[model samples]
Target: MLGGISIWQLLIVLGIIILIFGTKKLRNVGGDLGGAVKGFKKAMNEDEKGNDKSTDDPQARVSHDDEGTTYDVKAERKAEEQDERK
Candidate 1:
């Protein structure tokens, strides 16, 4: 019934996939996928915290380049001053 594929046809395809991969391998793959998603969520949360902190600090200015690289304005100015002195 789904795009011309009946429930029985869907079950057959599912069975074939299970037989090819086995239950254990499928379980491991699922666990790995879940872990990857968890890690991605954690990284996103940390990035948001970092952006918030940067905005809170008056001396810290964040800028993005064409390549999506972030720059800290205060840090860059300090580095430039050191280079000038050298």
Candidate 2:
């Protein structure tokens, strides 16, 4: 029984990989794959620390109003022009 992979099987797998991606390009694939795994793990650690702030935080408040804020310069200018016209 050939418990280990035969030379022909190894060659076939290598040939398929080379045909799909050239050897030189496949060389960098290893480093790129490792970096992706490392980034995922770092993100998981950050998430466990309760600091992924993209979601809402208790300390942050956003105010929305129909009257709008005082920084609405066009509204302020229109009001000033109306007052001057009177």
Candidate 3:
């Protein structure tokens, strides 16, 4: 028994869900859900592999503005915080 509901009650609830959604719609929904999970796993694996390569490259740490100005972003942020105190 789950939440005080017996196996028979659970079966009734499952039957209602299938009847409301229909078998084909339910199958499509299941497929879409599975695909999303697979894609998310693939992206996470790629990020882990990519981060190691990027961190070792100095140029990858610099961010460029639209005006073509480049700055050491971490240092610039610290400078801004110090300025706010004065």
Candidate 4:
């Protein structure tokens, strides 16, 4: 009785799916899906709150401390070295 499929037909399909995948695997998949949805909702709520705060304070700037950070830099090769390699 759902979109041209009978309740019995739905039950049969459900049974076949359960038989193919088993119950424990299905349960784990459902749990993972639920957790992902919950995390997504939490992130969305936090983003909305952040947007509100940013709107309220236009002059706010995000700053980071770079006290002891070192970047990997390669030494520059001279034109003579480049010509030798070529």
Give the candidate number with the greatest lDDT: 3
Q: What does the lDDT come to for candidate 2?
A: 0.84
Worst 10 residues of 1 by lDDT: 57-66
User: Candidate 3 deviates by what RMSD?
Assistant: 9.2
lDDT for position 30 in model 3: 98
Residues forming the 10-long window of minimal summed lDDT in candidate 4 = 71-80
For each candidate, the alpha-carbon lDDT, in order, equals: 0.89, 0.84, 0.90, 0.84
Model 4 TM-score relative to the real fold: 0.63
lDDT, candidate 2, 1-86, per-residue tens: 27888989988999999999998899899889999999999989988776667456665555555565357789889999999999
What pairs collide in candidate 3? none
Q: Residue 81: error of model 3 in Å?
A: 34
Candidate 1 local lDDT, 13-76, one digit each (tens): 9899999999999999999999999999999999888787876776565544467666799999
Instruction: Itemize residue pairs with steric clashes in candidate 1.
Output: none
Q: Rank the candidates by TM-score, best first.
A: 4, 3, 1, 2
Q: What is candidate 4's lDDT per residue for 1-86, written digit by digit as tens?
A: 46899989999999999999999999999999999999999999998888878846645754456757664344335655778899
Candidate 1, superposed: residue stretches over 4 Å from native: 55-86
Cα lDDT tens digits for candidate 3, 32-70: 999999999999998899888987778887766667666
CA shift at 71, candidate 3, in angstroms? 14
Runs of candidate 4 with Cα error greater than 4 angstroms are 55-86
- Provide TM-scores for the models: 0.57, 0.44, 0.61, 0.63
